[model samples]
Each structure stands twice: as C-alpha cells, then as structure tokens.
Target: MRISAVPDAADVDLEKIDLFDPLLYSDGDPHPIWTAMRQRAPLHRQVLPDGRQFWSVTRHGDACRVLSAHREFSSERGSLLHQLGKGDAASGKMLVSADPPRHSELRGPLNRMFSAKAVASAEPRIRRAVLATLPPPGHSGPWDVATSAALLPMAVAASFMAFPEEDWVDLVQWTSMAAAPEDPSFRVSSPAATLAIAHHQLFDYFAKHMRHRRANPGEDVVSYLTTMRAGSEQLTDEEVVYNCYSLLLGANATTPHTVAGTILAMAEHAPHFLRHGDADGTRVPLLIEEGLRWTSPASSFLRHAVQDVTLSGGTVREGDAVVVWVGSANRDEEVFSEPFRFDLTRDAGRHIAFGFGPHYCLGSALARIALRIYFSEFLRRFAGAELAGDPVHLRSNFIAGLVHLPMSLVPRAGT
Candidate 1:
C-alpha cells in the first residue's frame, strides 16, 4: 500500500526533524537527537517535506516489540523509509520482505548454509581470506580500513554465491555502491539513480549465473536456488534473482562497517585492549558484543503497521510506517548503563543490533565470525591505533558506518 500524507503535521520542520535525513548521519553525531527522543518521545513522528510520515521508535523495549510483532507490523509493505511512499517491489518474494509461513518456507533451505556449524567449518577459509587481504602486520602508517578490509566478507560471500574469485574486488565495489548509493563515492546521477543502476548491474550479473546454473548445477546457493523446490512449487526465476540480491546485500552491509566502527572505538577509547591475541578467546567475545552494540551498523529498518496498535502509550494507526532505530536502541540508557561509554566488559547481551523475531539477520553469524578473525589478526599485528583523521560516515539512514577510516596502526614493539 502506498503511504498517504499526514495532513495534521503540515507545520513540522522536515529538514530539522526528519529521521530519514542522510545529513543527520553524515554531518555529525545524531545520538543526542535520538537520546532526546528516546527519553521524551520514545514513540515519535517524522514528517517529510513531501508529506510522507512515519513513526520513529527509539527506546529498546519499544523497538524490540515493534520489530518482532510482525503480525501487527508488516515487512512485506517495505523495509526501509526510502520506500516510505512506494512499498517494496520485491515484497513476498525476498525472505527479508516476506512474513510468516511464506518466510519460513523460503528460509528453511537457506538456514543451514549459515548455521553456526557451517560458519565454524568455514573458519579455516575465512581466516585465510582475512590473512590474505589484511595489510602487512607491521605497517604503521595511515590505513583505509574500509577499503582494505572489505575483501574478507566479499570473499566469503562470493564463495557461497559461486561468484568468481577474480571478480571479488568488483563485487565489493558494486555492493558498496548498492549499499550506500547516496554517498558521493558511489553516486552516479543521483542517489536513487545510483541505487537503480547498481541494482540493474547486479541483477543482470546474477541472471547470467542463474541461467548458467540451470543446466550446470553446482553446490552454491545460487545453483541451489535455480533448482530447489518449496514443497510442490518452484521459485520463479525472479524469486531466485531477488534472493541473490538479498544475499549479496546482506554480505556487504554490516561487517566491514562494524570493523571500521570497532576500530574507531578502539582508536578513541579501547586501544589498551589491542595487540593481545586473546589467546583464551574469552576476551574477544566481550569485545565483539560491545563493539557490535556500540557501532550498531544496521542502524534502522522500516515496518509499516498492518493494524491499529498501541505501543509505548502511543496509538499507531493501520498503514502508518514505523522506523525502528536499532542504533539508538542499542544505546538506550535503560538497557545499557552509560550507553555512550565504550566498555568492553559490559554485558551487551540484550542488544537488538540483529533485530528480533523472524526477520533477524540471517548472516549475523557470518558478521560475527568475520569480526572475530579480523580483530584477532589485527591485534596480533598492531599494538594500538588512533585516528589520523575523522571517520567519513556513510550517508545512509538504514546502515550506519564509516566510509573511510583514516588511522595509523601501531605495530607490535620492535616490528
């Protein structure tokens, strides 16, 4: 359903108040605004100059309830505020956009591919990919972590999709543009145009492989999709294509930024934790949880209400869009004491950075695995690091991250 304008909010200042504004993320820290809203207006309203309106959920409990209550809040409508007016075209076809029984049927075959055991078994290759792509252990000049470290996730994802190894670098570039189309680094004619072009290129690329896999089937996810059945029904060729797009997007969106953001946090507050290999593995878990909580890269996701529902004392009418700020929820004062402080020891177990319910990130395990290996190797090489320049943030409301992280690595003593 197309979202209609809220005539009641005609006087609101969209430029200053719109939660979907990219400038809120790119220009400076937006935490204060979120903090204010979380406390004073946990269930807030955001109206765009164009008249599109959405409810902004900022508190942890409210965020969780809204994200998980799929019956009341529909994912098939749209999953991002960028589609506030026009709902998702790939709805009901892609797993991320499907709800209930359909979502379950579609997800069952794919779950094992990223199960914990699967990721554990893939660790050897993941470690090798990390080792191969990482800069020299002792190099101590300014390093662009975003550009250099993106290969590990891309490599891991490409292997699963059966994308060629030689195309890994190109895949990385395409995925990044597709992920953060508004960033000047990726913008072609405009943000919308950039996103469209990137998707066009990606869809055409996946179509070639999908068609090839029809006759020459392989063990990869795309190959499986080309032939796999859901009970008596086969996935339409478009469904296979949409799933491929979703998987490629999942691989590119989270971890690299999480790495860059964690590195930023390390440079800023937790440098003392570096250089130790975490030989026991226990310390790394705390660091990983806290880093994911602090960074919160999958910043916001959209859900349109399917029914009139009351949440956190506010009534959300049917058809109203709700944007849950996972980034803000991670920092909710009630959930994390002094949520702003980067405390590696704090138990960040309640973090809904992965969202909640059926729509939770399928690649959460892979993202964690990527971070675990990357940090272990990073610390063994560098004693500590600090920012050489400000981190360039991605101009996206859905994904929060560093576009470029300029940092000087401190090599292990003597090397």
Candidate 2:
C-alpha cells in the first residue's frame, strides 16, 4: 500500500516541494504525501531552492528514532525549517533547539512548574478565569473562541511564572509573533523584526521582575529559576529570560488551540454529542486528545543529522536538515488505527503532537490542565455549543491553530 515517491528534483522545480511554507504543512493534509513516503521512500530526499538537501522522515517509528536518538540527529542545528539567520541568539537557547546536556540542564530545574501537581493546584484560579470568559447562559451567536479560550492558559501560566497580569495582552502578542515566525502578515515585514520587538519587550519586562524575584524569591517557577544553582552551572540572565519567554509562548499558543480545536471536532461530529447527554464533563477530555492529534499545533520539527546516517535506504549526509512530519505521523495507519476516524476512546498517547524523545514538550501537564479546565467549564456551561460560522486558521504552517473560531453557545436543558 505504498505510494510512489515523487523525486526531490521533479516536483520541486515548479514550486511543488515547498517545506518552508507553514500553510502547506499546517493545512493538516500531509498524510497523502506522507503515506506515499512511508510506503515507498520512507527516507525521501528533498532539495530546497537554495540546494539544501534534507531527509523527509514520514513514518511513526522513523520519526521516533530521529527525535530520540539525539546522538545521531541533533537539535542544535535548528528545530524548524526557518533559516538560522545571523545574530539569532534566542533561537539557540530555547529548549526546542538545544541538544542534550545543555537542554537537559536547562529543562531539569523547571520540570516541577509543569508537573501535574503544580498544574492541578492552579485549578481554582484557572476555573475562575474560564468562568469569567464563558458566554452567558442564553447567549447564541458568533464570537471569537480563540481569544476567550486564551485567558485560561495565559492567566494560569503568568500567575505561576510571576508574569505581570496587566501585561498579559502584550505577552500574548509577543509570544504569538515569536512562535509563528513565518506569518508575514502578523506584523511588519520579517519574522525577525517581530521577534526582535517581542524579545526586547519581554526581556525588559522580565528584567524588572527578575530584580524583585531575586531579592525576594517566591514559590513561583520564575523565582525558582532565578535562584537555582545547578552545580556551579546555574542559568544565566539571558537563559532565564528566554526560558520564560519560550515557556510563555509555548504554553499560551498550544493549549487554547486544543480547546478551540476540540470544540470544532465536537461540532463536526455532532452525532458524538448525543453520547454525553447535555453534560460535556464526560466527553471533553477525549475531545482534547483527538483535537491535539488532529490539529497538531507544533506540526513539523526540523533536525540536522550529525553524521552520514542511512535512513530508510536513503543516504542522509552530515549537516543535512531533516524535517520530521509529526502531523503526518499522527495519521499514519501503521501506528494509529483508522487514522482518519476521530475515535474518542482511541489511545493516542503515542502521537507526536507534542513531539518525541528528549525534546518532548516540557509543559505538557500544564497544557493538559489548561485544556481540561477550559473544556470542563465549556461543557458545563454550553453543551449545545456549535460553530456559528466557519473558523479561520492561522496562515502560517508553523504552530498551526485556529486564529478565529466564530461560535455560539447555548445552555443545555438537563444541566
């Protein structure tokens, strides 16, 4: 059942094999080509316009190998397809791009912040935030669910990390620009410009807070990060600043999309709505997992092979960039049963929605907490909720998620 591999040269000549555009990858339709790759050329070679040759790893098992075998495929080269432009210091420090030892060292101390206990403990506050934003009992019309859904994760994350509440809106803006660097229309020209503005704004904001946190370290993750001493290898100011910056963007962008995507999934499969009665409590968690697997916010991750390693009988030479198609892997039939069917009870734990191996999402627990809280409250409030209009997904392929979810909420009778 393998589809033939379209050679890197043939399709690429006419702007066919574009790995750079986030829209192409983020459209959530890589399976057709990916299936072809897995069955025929599991290790297909791709050539960028600039003549950069990369190995496209499409299957579930091979993707896992690339992500896990850090020794073989290094994250140091880059984590996405974006060019590593000169003076891009922040990209290197972010956990997504760093290799082991350094990555492990940076991520180790802050694990507790994203742990289940810590996230669970923030439920009361998260619930309040979600409740505040829910549509009133009888409301039913198009409204932006993405903006409303964002409050839960951002509020919880800011509170946990000691980020200022008044700055939440700006923080969200900064993080969005940083995460979706490929989106030209998000702001002025160049993803670099957007990132530079965001970096300075966030760094200045954090520097002010860092002074206070250093003087009187609290129970928050930022406080812990500021004071941590990892055997004479504590985090530097830049690391601390960028780590918070990265965490804020990562935590904010993904979870809300999960909530929005889950709602869309529910609306699309209205038949499933019958199973949960008017109570969404029963159906929300399952919806979250499927939404994550379906939408796959992180989409594709970029890795560089350290040495010449033969993958799927193709030769990936040293210094070659490898694009790991995660969304494709999520839909691979070999790993997931009936990959297209949105089965609520399916065990999708193995999906690479969050990525694989050492660089797996650090804030997974927190992301889940935010998603669960929003859905739990959403279900409780609006069981009969459905999309009032077609949703708009972000233009960029990187960090794919709904930019606008126009939906109406209605109260259920039983509840």
Candidate 3:
C-alpha cells in the first residue's frame, strides 16, 4: 500500500499510502483518505498488491480536469480497475471506455433517448409507475425506501428501454455486483461467474429485442437504437446489449440512492420540511440534487493515461492509471459552501454527481424526471413519512445506495 512520494518533499512531508485495503472505500469511510489527500497530498500515486499503480485524484478541481481532459487521460482503457474477463470483455465495446470519435459514435444514438422532450413525454408513465409501486396509505410500520425506490425505477427504466419487467430485479442485482465486486455485500459470486451471467443475460435479452424492433419498431429507445449506424458500422448485438445494460444499472442504482438519501436528509432537516410545508414534492426535486451532491453514487472512475501529463502539481507518466474520486469532488470545500451539510435549497446543479464531459451520463435527464415523479408522488401519498427503523448503507463504493430503509408511511390528509 506504499505511495510514491510527492515532489519538493520539503514542503509536503506526508507518508504516502494506498487509499486503503482493496475493499476499504466500499465500506463507507472515504473521508479519512479523501480529507488527508485533499489537505496534504491531493495527487498521491500509490501501488497496489497486483503491481498496478495509479494516481489518486482526490481534490475537486483535479477530478474535473481529469474527467474533462479526454486527450491526456483516456477512458478508453475502461472505467474500473477490475479488468473484464474472457466471457464479457472479449465480446464488444462498453460505451464508458471508448475514446473521442468512437465515444461520440457510441453515445450519439443513446443520447437522443434522453433528449428533454423525450424524457418529458415519459413523465406520466413514470409517475404512474411510481404510484403503482408505493405502499398504499394506512399501511403501518417500517418499509425499505431503498427497495421501494429501487424496484420502481428499474421497472420503469426497463419498460422505457424495452426490457420485460419480470427481469428487472435480477438485472439490478447483476449490475450492482459488477460495479463493485470488492464489497462483500455486492459480491454475489466470483468475478468470472458474475461477468458470465451478465454477458449471457444482457446479450441474449437484447439480441432478441433488436430483431423484434427491426421487424416491428416501437417508440422506445431500443427502437431508435435499431436505426442508428455508427459511421456505416452499426453497433454489434453485444454493443447494444452492453449499452442497454449500462442504462438499466445507471437508472436503478443511482436514482434510488438519491431517493433514500433525500428522505434521510429531510428527516434530519425537519425544519426545511416544516418551512416548505405541503410543498414537499416541489422541494423534493431540489432535495434530490442536494442528496446527489452529498452521496455521489458513482464514487470514482478509473482512467489510463495515454501520455505523460502534469496534473495537480504532480507529473503523471504515460500508461499510469488515475482514479478520479467523484464523491470527494462534490464535497470539496473549494467549490461548495459548507460542503458536508445537506442544504435542501442549495444550488447543486453544478455538482458532477452524474459526472462531466463527453462521458457524462446520458441517462441524467431521465434520472431527474424519475426523481421528480418519485418524490412528488411519494410526498403526495405519504405526507409525514418518518423513519421507523435504522437505515443501512450499501457496502459498495462504486455505487452507493441504501440497502434497507425502514420507514412508516403516514397518509396525507384527504388522500
């Protein structure tokens, strides 16, 4: 876990170390590593047990620079440290890993589905889905907001993407594990088994749908994908599968975490809810942004450098891996005022919770719409939602969300 020392050793005399054990960040104590790096050594280089060395970008501005600067540091090498195995990695291109011209080609079609007008049109269906899943009024005792939120978004997102609703939960389980295998809770099986299952499930599912869309086109995103040609080179069956799989994971994992985080934040900041009164749904969207700023779902993305580049006053050599800490950046004091406090009214749109640059999340607009509808309906149905039991956090750093949120749903007056 030894880290290469920073230059001009006299000024910054800091003991260099790996952020933590392989699984530490996933366990929920990123602040100790992030706080130390931000103050003492914002750009620390560390070597891992596997002989892999990476530059840890912990500060706010540095993260943005790495994410936005596509030329120097490339996402082409893939976004995570765990290399894809023979079963999946050998098959096709994952959009998050591609560079420039190729990246644009891969994302072009998918981005159309998230266009403002398209997402806005999906609002009624999304709201109806939310209302359908929510516990009916007068239901007593605690309930898992995470499970509740997680279930609805996956179903709605899958429906929008043309996947059968029956397979929704399993898709979520697979993606959650694939995103953070190091975390014990998310490790359903060995890396190989997880990859194999994901590869088989997603590819087979989309391959069939692609044919169906070609024969009988629908208004959904997958239908649009069928017509796209990536510069006379259309995405192979695997590419379409992986892209759709990524969308499902994105909508399911991140949005639900924000939902649970918003509820927890509201409980803590009861005065805000009191001040807003019955305008909870309107205020919930603001709360969603604030929660995303507070608990960024995709905590970090790993990128490999194509050439030597100096960043954060540190020199990064070619082929070096840089771990950009997204959550740390969202909370950096330089950019945020009282960064830790969950201020419901704070301007959180600028936060890189959904990431930045060309690789920014294409499903972001859709995610916001889902959140607005989720919270809007949630507040409308259950006016005085109170925590009925202790909430548990997910044991994964890559995608943070609640595991179990026990709550009592108090019905709103006249509902």
Task: Give me the runs in candidate 2 sitting further than 4 Å from their true place.
Answer: 1-15, 25-29, 84-93, 274-282
Candidate 2 Cα lDDT to native: 0.70
Instruction: Please list all clashing residue pairs in model 3, or write none if there are none.
Output: 143-407
> Can you write out model 1's per-residue Cα lDDT over 179-240, one digit (the tens) per residue?
88888877898888988888888889888989999889998889988777754688889999
lDDT for model 1: 0.81
lDDT (C-alpha) at residue 112 in model 2: 60
Alpha carbon lDDT of each predicted model = 0.81, 0.70, 0.70
Report, for all candidates in order, the number of backbone clashes: 0, 2, 1
Please give the distance, in angstroms, between residue 9's alpha carbon in candidate 3 and its true position after superposition. Answer: 21
- State residue 359's C-alpha deviation in candidate 3, in Å: 1.1
| Model 2 residue pairs with clashes | 22-397, 23-397
Residue 36 displacement (Å), model 2: 3.2
Each model's TM-score, in the order given?
0.94, 0.88, 0.88
In model 3, the Cα lDDT at residue 412 comes to 63
Question: Per-residue lDDT for 280-335 in model 3, tens only?
Answer: 35677677788778768777788777889888858899888888888778877788
